[model samples]
Target chain A: MNLRRKKLWMTVTLAVLAAAVILIPAPALAANPIERFVMVEASQYAFTPATLHANPGDTVTIELHSADVAHGIYVEGYGVSAEAQPGQPVAFTFVVTESGVFRLRCSITCGALHPFMLGRLTVGPNWTLARAAALAGLAVLAAPLAVRRETA
Target chain B: MNRVSLLQIPWLKAALKNRWPQFTISALLMAGFVFAIVAGLVGTPVGSRNFGIIAVWIAWWAILILAVVPVTGRGWCSVCPIPMAGDFLQRRSLLGPNGGRTRGLNLRLPKLFRNIWWQNAAFALMAIFSAAILTNPRVTALALIIMLVAAIGMSAVFERRSFCKSVCPVGGFIGLYSQVAPLELRVADAAACASCASKACYNGSEAGYGCPWGTFPAGLTRNPACGLCLECLRSCPNDNIVLNLRPFAADLEKPAARLDEAFKAFLMLGAALVYAAVFLGPWGNLKVAALAAGTWPWLGYAAAFLLICLALLPGLFWVAVRLAKRMAPAKPHTARRHDFAQAAAALVPLGLAFWAAFSLSFVFANGSYLLNVLSDPLGWGWDLFGTAGAVWSPLYGSWTVAVQVGVLALGAFGAARVAQRAGARGGLHPLPVSGYSLALTVVMMGLLL
Candidate 1:
């Protein structure tokens, strides 16, 4: 194959692989939502604040940081995962519509306890649209403060 | 019977030569990897953990061992330590003392018996044991120890590459599949080889070892016994040795010469077939119990299975060899063993398809539980880590099956092309109908799986 063709094929391959690893469905909601500014600490095998809960139609932007080592946060159902390194936080946003609790697990084998490490989020009956709107305002305002602290 | 010659592909030729060092290093690097796996099995707890990691490991091993190794030919063998261990133990002097003379207690064996059957036997032995312990920590440990012992034992007796050429399942795998690998090492100038005299490549030297597999470098034109060791490359004064970057599956052929290589290919096909039957077949329950029980009766049954899988199949190959001889166009009485060997090459693709079918179910059956297991083990609160919504994800299985089927199809097509090319040289007609049937078989396997 020629150089151009090789590059084109390689790009195509990478794109496909990326799609396989990262494709997920958007959350279903009834307009009003819970907005949560969440921080997740990932390690070699486990992630802290592993279980996350929010009302129906809640939106979450998780600021993920690694405490000890490299870990991949792969959510199989959602098809979203982020690579977490020590002290470096990654951002990922997702909304869950299913009212039941969803299980979460580390995709990477980080340490000895990798097998036992797990957490889950319990979505409750108290979820409402008005409260979610208020939470969204807090989230927009809070991100700037976090960025300012980061710069400082 | 790959009838094609890929020598005309110049870019491939250059790419092969340029990438030699990387492949050489990678070969040796793989030995270290085997060591790490052994170490992990020995030191880590014997408990079963998450299934996802197991799936990944299994998939990685399959891709690397079955698909990758076989296609690349003696590329892996060049650096495989299984042979090196035997060479070291058997050869007293590491640096070929007495000017690389073949003068010592470790005498070279007869040329006729230096085929891949012995190695096939060894590989089969491992497969029997692997039935249960392939996934287990203790079994993997025992398996590694056995390999170490084999290396030590073979080196004590054989002159060079006794374990690698004669034994080692992984070696057999690579040798068989390597016919399909795009990269190959070969002679730069056949004319140079024809004219040259020292024969330093086949015979030893003070500088480096000879072709341990007993391949006379001057005579070799294809990639069967050539270990990609580059010893001959350096030893050759003719400047004839060079690695070829060629179309994959270029060497699948029906030969009139190189009898041992023909047998080795058959042995490889047989191994692939048996591996599928044992690993993927419905009899897995009995296979598992037979090993873990560890009684004499169980051992006997397991041994019987091994015999049927490895030895019986090779025996059938020899029979096929005889049958293939009659099928040859011109000569029936003196049909070459090489022809039989080339036909054996067709077995690779069929076996590959079987493996893909077997592994696909695990993608759906076992994947979700692994994702679920992580939350409790390391106390990660993330719900997919513990997420209830993550349960019953079936795409992982379907995607894996698709990938495997693709690999299988490619392998089948390549094998058929090479077989057809080789068969044509012997004046045999191409088996396009048979090829189509095999292709359909592979497709059906994916759809069914």
Candidate 2:
């Protein structure tokens, strides 16, 4: 390959790798779909149904309730939040257009394990996992190539 | 090795020469420290609202990770209140020179506990309970008070700053990561140090006391042990002591890596990974197991934590080293153990970066509480600053992932470069070592990002 072509290819490859690294997270998107309600219970350092699944364009209404003290749900990447006092259900709805794994954490100062209170939400066809794997592969392959290039 | 000596600057020299500035900063920190302990004991149980938790875990941690350790090596140690209390009690005066007389027993630190092994163990013990400690105001206060008492007790029974040098859990990692800090303290002229008959930097002088952490400034090549107390700067009659502003990771080029130090790097990287998984990862059962202390699940969790930190990560790293050895063009006289040690040292920069990246999520996401808790220290409906009712808002939100990736990449590249250097020093090929580091970097990126 010519020097210019080689440089172009290298730039393209690096751009793709960068994209793969940053592809795991996304904000909520506008989509019309049947709304599905998810009833989630937050206890001491845990959330019921720790893993929730949804289709790409599905609207998710999460009714968050604290089994113990006051708690709040802060969904990662969606910018959706709700506060739930004990026995009081707080409903938050958002359209899930991001096809990736996101975390829902207790936002309130709940207890000693407040920081650890977490749950996972997986949108269908999780591209984040595939992109992460691709990133890893790119690292493994590119490391040797860079080393050789330096030595050369 | 090129350095810009701070003492060369007239204003900086004048400022450092005076004890009042250092004393004032130390006193302020001491007051804050006392307030944290009091707030933890008597304040609200809520971690976010409590001043102790918000200030110590959120605000102080943010500064420590994002500013202090990266920019200044052991700068926090210079003004640390923990050792201030011990030093004051031992010297019998805050500003006066020890005059070759320490009030404490002044017994030597145990020969077996001389190296950083005790520190590593203490850090591991703290890591095990870190989840609880980070969120509980009472627990956090108790831990600080215990350390304070321990520091005082150690000063009374043992020698100077033994708690900091040999026992403090937080100090261990601070010391480890301080190697990467840009600022360093050293004697400017080696010949001057050699010619001087009175090594007042190590011993005491009329101007200042001896090195509190037992470090002789002349032989200082690294920032790991030297608690930058600035006593050496004051005590040196030859004026040999120089604080230099330099590049980061200047001390990572060890001729021979100590096993304890290498293991410290491993522990730091491993613990960062584990903490990321438990605190940030989408796993509820793991968090539950981590929280339930003394239970069967908790024991299992503890075992797994220890295994990952002590065995699995080190074992994987050893395999990487072995593979590097096999792939590299072998040098006839080189010892495998020595090469292994060198390879581990190369990971120090990456380890520090891993910590920084992990800490970003911690400090940024939860850091907003600093405002709320500052205004209402005890969460007792007292809005001193009118910002007590401030809403909890995480800054930069999802952009943190990108920042973390960038930081990790920087660290990974640094580690690769260091590995290449080590490879050249040992007459080996750099490819495999760099490859191993890249693999580890990808793993960290996957975990955090």
Candidate 3:
């Protein structure tokens, strides 16, 4: 094929591939409801079992235990918080209404790295990450075709 | 391809020529800098509530990376306050040239240490201890004071702005990425500059001080060395100096020729990766080690940080360059060292993007602290703005991840274009370099998302 025709074909193919990636259907929801109980230990600047997973619409009961100082666990997207003192465990229950990754941060000042003390709550599959990965791959593939070759 | 001279605008030209406006801005910033030092030393130990930490790290850092560097190209350096005290001590007059009666030894910077190697080392040293300096207000205060004293000391001995040009850590990265900014200060008529005998731009002519950055306008071709101080414009008798708006990344069309600058790209890119993993990732042990500062784990962390920035990343890139050479050798047989430096130009955009993306997450999460700190600057419970009681909250939520992904994608594309241009110069293949950028982007995305 001629150069112009070849370029046109490549552009069209890339567009189709991008659409396929973006339009891919998410996994079907689970038919039965379930309850997940997780115990998270909070220390000076870390949370034990830093990541928690649950299905969308499932009830998640998180019991926070402070191993050292006073600490509070606040979940982003859920907007629920629980405070636990040393030797005392506080629990909060929230329904996972969405299907994305959320950060669980320390609501109370703990130490020097208090702001960065964090954990992840994943509900269902992390499709945002999957889609971002796909888009990034497509971006790398599309880059060379976007610029014309120039002679030195 | 076309350039519009900003000097043609009457009021801007007048404002730039007048030293008062620049001096006033620098003075205000210096006051803020002094206040930050005081706040850090005596204020509340809470880093989130301390003005020293929130204002400088969050507010100023966001503005420098997201707006100033990308839009103005070393514009921050034009009025930077760190060098103001030094300039004052050296010149003995702030308003004008002082009739060329400057003080100090006025010795030239040594030939061996003239390049940005000092800047690279200084920046690495700071990065190794950044977790502590970024978190503890006292450490931040000490770091700021050290920088201030270093600038004054360099100015007391060196001729002009040797600290900013070759020593300042932040200035080093700003200079490297300024190559992508659209704005440039250049001579409108090179012939005018060549014919002029006084050459007031580099030497004081009573109208203004000489180029603080120590660059000659006639030989200027890129944005890395030009601080955009406009001294040349104030001192030019023939009206030859002009600030122009041109295409972005215009300077990267010419490949990098210096090894120090090339290593700067590697260092910055590696820093972004390491910072993301340490600061934004869920690795708690890493954070502890980074903040422990001078302990065994911290020492190990520091060693790994330097090794990654100085050896591992650059080694991998060199291997890529070697692979490219084998895959597509230059017809004219370009030297490997030259090709390595030239190919590093592609990392400038990628590094800038990585920093911007990382800053977005950090800024959005902690930006609200700026309000509280503004009201209670010293955290002594003074509510100047009635925001001292403001609650802490993260802004934009999960949208930050989406925005970070978009920024990284744009950066990858820009880097690919630069790599393609470098490949066209006959030494390197674009694929390996572009692949390197793409892999880093994916890893960064994984970290942020």
Candidate 4:
């Protein structure tokens, strides 16, 4: 019973640590209190704007549209993810606290070269993190309507 | 299984003994599976890089389930990955009122929520997005850890047999398919059981053990809710309930009636349907949006569920019920319920058939993944065999379609055999309900497989 209780405590501690690791980024990579826009287009497992530049403390929203199949916009260095739709546009938003070059990739299972789907994001000074985030959000909000109008 | 040595078939005797070995292999397998997911996040398996999620799952599950069953009987139930998390909460052994040892302090589930089909539906929901589930390290890690913790906790708190029979999906499959096993535990005498007073099957006394599944040995079939735990083997005084040497695929004399058994059929049917619609269906919209809505998947899934229940299930059931009514015009109405149950039970064979089909697909589809594993044993890349994902590499690739078709036929044969064993007594018009239901399940699986 003591062993089990200990095990349970360990599990809880581990879970908490894991959650912290995921939810809270490093102090250096402090979240941009708010984010702005960063629309990335995905085609044949590659993002259109393969490289992005932004400032720390910015909440960047990424509006993603897939040209071929299902593609996930994943920011590895910052633990960011956005799954893209083939026809419709999908979006994800995250705060950029850490200033560094974050490698992004398509996490969705597209096809042969799905693994090669790559991009880069540089977060540093002169970054209007909140504005970039707002812009990203606005882009996301505007996408569906734009798509609808085009289809209509 | 505790019987005379069979020199004739060494394999069958071994199967009966190892029918269940309290497997911890799955915990290990799950650890590897978890590692794979982490690999996906941090690095990538060059093998699975080009492979579909469905193919990977199919390949792994096929090798595991098929190989495990023939050697271990119903052992997989103990280690099934899907239900391990649910089992902890679903346990019946927790403390409760109106109880000395409460039958179950089990999760007080709703009536509709009781069936295995519900579990199957749950599995379908997971499987549809299993790509993300399998690849995401955080998700996979959480799932594995959850399962490990739940299993250990449930085992510690609950009585033996309570968790496995009721909660796990893999266990559900093991129990359902175990009826096809060659060996079984059965009472030597029904008359002896009626006269005996200290029914060890129920109230297991100090002298003899009781059936943990809450079943009487005399009343038990092969491995219905029985966990193959063998506690009763020690408890019986008369030595009445003996494990018998039966033929291969022997438990066909009766149809099963557990909600667990019923759900597996639904799971198999649902799995086949999901794959077809997702991969081969004419719907272009779902295909296009398959990626975008990964985080929140309920949208597409809700639509799929509606399509299956409101449409496909009804269509199949209607056609089946009609044909059944026609085939067995002479069968009694009481027998019809039994027939319906049996037909539903026949889904076991159909389910197995689909496994074979899926296995065939794995050899073709994910066999590519294996090549990467083979060349890069350490996964260092640069194909040693020079045929990494070389399309024509695997030998089974030659006849995958043919193998699938053959498996479907075998499934039909197996179902007919099961019907006969279930006492269907299929004459020219033995029991139309079973024939039709079995036929429909087979036909649908055949097309889908």
Candidate 5:
């Protein structure tokens, strides 16, 4: 192929791959949404159940139990929080409205690594990771093709 | 791409040539630096609430990684406070050159210890104990004091800015990644520099001191050694020096020719991956092990970290380069060391992007502490800015992940382009390096997202 045709082909291929990655719908897996009762144990700097999974429209009731000191769980994207003492467990319910992964951070200063203490809440499929990976692959494929090879 | 000389602007050139602007900024930052030490020494033990941790790590670090280094190479070094006191002691004057005289024993650094190997070691040491220094206020203060004293001692012993040039952990990575930045300092008329009787840029003049980083401006083809101090601009008699705005990563067209720099690329990339896994991932045991300083677990973590950075990553990259050389239909006599170092240049952009993505998540999540710490630097119930009562809140929660993905994608793309260029120059295939970068990006994505 000529240089112009090769360039055209490369551009078209990249655009198509990007669109397929971004616009393609994820397979529906939540036909029957149910309630998920998850008991999360919070220790010095970690969550017992590091990741929680639920389907869209399903209710997730998280019971936060502090294993050591007073700790709290703040769910990102949901903007809801629950606090628990050493023995006392605090529970909060939120509907899984988002279809991506959100962080669960410690709302209280438990220790030195308080800010780093984290967990994840995955509602349905994590299409964000999938799409991002696919886009990254597309970028890698397209980058070298776009560069002009310098002649000696 | 065309280069626009920022020195063409009269007022900007005048400001840069004058000593007051740089001096004033450095002085103010030095005051803040001292205050951070004091706060760290006496303030509340909570790392989040301490000014030293928040200001230095979160606020200043955010600006340095997200803006300063990416937008203007070595812009932070122009006003960094770490070497200010040392410079003052060495020159005996802050505002001007005292007829280009110096104080103390201005001994030359031994040639064997001249490269960035010391910097690599220093940075590795800091990275090993980063969990402690970044968390404990006392540890942070002591670390700062050690760096300050070391800089002062090095200045007293060796010649111009040797500490920054050869020992500063932060400066090492800054210099490495600064090659990707669009801004650069160079001589506009090379013949003018060649014809000049007095090389005042390296040697001091009445107008300004010599290059503090000990680099000759006329020979500069890359950004690593130049600190962007603009001393050469003032000292040059024929006005040969020009600060130009050029294409990003313009320096990467030519691969690095040193093994130390290649190792630096690997070290930084590996550090980023380790930090992502330890600090941001959902692995609690890893965090505990990293935080438990002096314990066996911490030792294990440190050893593993060192192995990954110094051995595993570089070993894997070397294998990839060797494989590429064997596969390529080029001269079989190409030097193995040359091929490896050249191909390793491809990791520079990817390493920078990894740091940016990691800093984005860390700073965005913890940036709110800046307000609280600013108001109450000592955490002594003082609300100087009325934000002491502000609550902890992560900013742009889910959007941060999206931005991280975008940044990583861009970084991967840049790395691929650089790999192709390096391959073209080194008579090797670009696929292995590109594949390595892609695999790391996927792992980074997995750790982060």
Candidate 6:
């Protein structure tokens, strides 16, 4: 094929590949009708289960318990927060309205590494990871062809 | 071409030519350093609440990564406190020239040990122990004290900034990345430098000492080694030194690239990814391994960390480069490895973006402590700033997500452009070289998102 044609073909192929990767349908968020319950134990420097995964529209009722000193949970994006003392559990509920990862951080001054003490709330149908991976593949594949066209 | 020389501004020229501004800044930073060390030793042990940790890791580190390196290349180096004590001791003057006689032995650094290997090693060592260092004020203090003593000792033995040039871990990476910063200090005219007989920039003039970072400004092109001390500006007899505000990543366009620098790039990219996963990711096991000392899991973590940083990432990159070379329009006359090494510069922007994005995640999420710590730096219940009781809250919230994505995209584009330019200069198609950059973007996006 001619150089122009080759470049055209490569671009189209990249676009199609990227589209295919992104459109690889995972199970949709908010498909389930059940409420999710998880117990999160916060301590001086770490959270028990570092990640909590759920789907959009699912009610996630987290029972926050302090392993050591008093600690609080501050869920990002969602304005839900609570404080729990040692031997006392504080519960809070929030519906995952967004389909992305949100940080759940300690609101209290736990200890030395209190700042980094946190967890993740991954509301499902997180297509960003797939899309990013696909784009990367496309970029790698198309880059050489694009450079060739430039040089040509 | 998109640039104006800062020296053209009369006030800027006057300020740069004078020693007072830089001297004052350096002195202040040194004082802060001393305060940090004292506090780390005598005051609060809590890393989040301690002045030493909060000031150094939160405020200073956030600013350094987010602002200083991005806007002004090597600007921090000009006022870094590590070298202040050494410089003062060597010159025997805080703000004036020492009559061309330094108090130190003034010995030349050994030729065999030159280059950034020492810095790479030092940085690697630090990265291995960063978990411990970041969480403990005492450990942070010890590290600072060690660096200070080492800088002083090196100054006493070797001539002019041997420690910063060839030893400092932070300086090494900062120097490497500073190539992408718009600000640069270069001689105005090469002809003037060549024709002049005095060579005052290298050997001290009455106004200033010799280039402290052991570089002759006449031949300097990259920011990796130049500390931006501005000694050359004061010492230049021919009035050739000019500080230019040029386009970013100007130095990355240099015709030749080095393996050490390429390796540094890989190390940086890998470290940023691993740090993100360990420090920010929802992985408790990883953090445990990273933070736990003298355990099998910790050893495993360290080994994996080093392997990933030093080998796995580079190894993957090498494969990508090899694939690109095979598919390249023009076959390279040089060894494939050499070409791959040179092409590694293409990914520098992406690496920088990774660091920026990581810093964004880290600093924003934890930055609220700065207000509280400022008021209660020692966590001794002393509300010095009256803002000590400020509640912990992450800054910017989801706003950082959008900004990080934009930054990564810009970095990818820059990296691609760099690869194309480098390829054109080397009589090759640049596209193949961009593969690594594109792939790295994916990784960065994954981490950041």
- Return the TM-score for candidate 5, rounded to 2 decimals: 0.98
Over the stretch A53-147, how does candidate 2's per-residue lDDT look in tens digits? 88788889999988989988888888789989997898988998767677777888777777667787888655554555455445444543454
Per-model TM values vs. the true structure: 0.57, 0.89, 0.96, 0.56, 0.98, 0.91
What would the per-residue lDDT of candidate 3 be over residues B314-351, giving only the tens digit for each residue? Answer: 89889987877777755557788888888889899899
Which candidate ranks first by TM-score, i.e. highest? 5
TM-score of 1: 0.57
Candidate 4 local Cα displacement, residue B353, angstroms: 0.4
Model 3, residue B126: what's the lDDT? 94
* Superposed Cα deviation of residue B141, candidate 2 (Å): 1.6
What range of 10 consecutive residues in model 6 chain B has the weakest lDDT sum?
Answer: B424-433
The CAPRI quality class of candidate 2 comes to acceptable
Q: How do these models rank on TM-score, best leading?
A: 5, 3, 6, 2, 1, 4
How high is the CA lDDT of each candidate model?
0.52, 0.79, 0.87, 0.51, 0.90, 0.81
Q: Residue A137, candidate 2: how far off, in angstroms?
A: 8.0
Whole-model lDDT, model 5: 0.90
Ranking according to lDDT, highest score first: 5, 3, 6, 2, 1, 4
**Best by DockQ, which number?**
5
The number of clashing residue pairs in each candidate reads 61, 0, 0, 33, 0, 0
Misplaced by over 4 Å in model 2 are A1-36, A54-57, A85-88, A97-101, A122-152, B332-335, B427-429
Candidate 6 residue runs with Cα over 4 Å from true position: A1-34, A43-45, A128-152, B426-433
Candidate 4 stretches greater than 4 Å from native? A1-152, B1-60, B70-73, B78-121, B134-141, B149-158, B188-216, B231-252, B257-263, B277-298, B309-311, B335-339, B371-395, B416-449
- lDDT per residue as tens, model 6, B231-253: 99998888888888887888877
- Report lDDT (Cα) of residue B38, candidate 4: 51
- Chain B: TM-scores of all predictions: 0.69, 0.96, 0.98, 0.67, 0.98, 0.97
Candidate 1 residue spans exceeding 4 A from truth: A1-152, B1-41, B44-60, B85-104, B110-112, B256-287, B293-342, B352-397, B422-448
Between 3 and 4, whose TM-score is larger? 3
- Sorted on DockQ, best first, the list reads 5, 3, 6, 2, 1, 4
Tens-digit per-residue lDDT, B332-447, candidate 4: 45444444455565556656666656555434433445555444333445577865534322333324544554555455545544543343343213243334434544444333
Q: lDDT by residue for model 2 over B46-160, one digit each (tens)?
A: 8888999988988888888778988886888888888887888889998979675798788999998788888899888878887778888898999999989988999998888
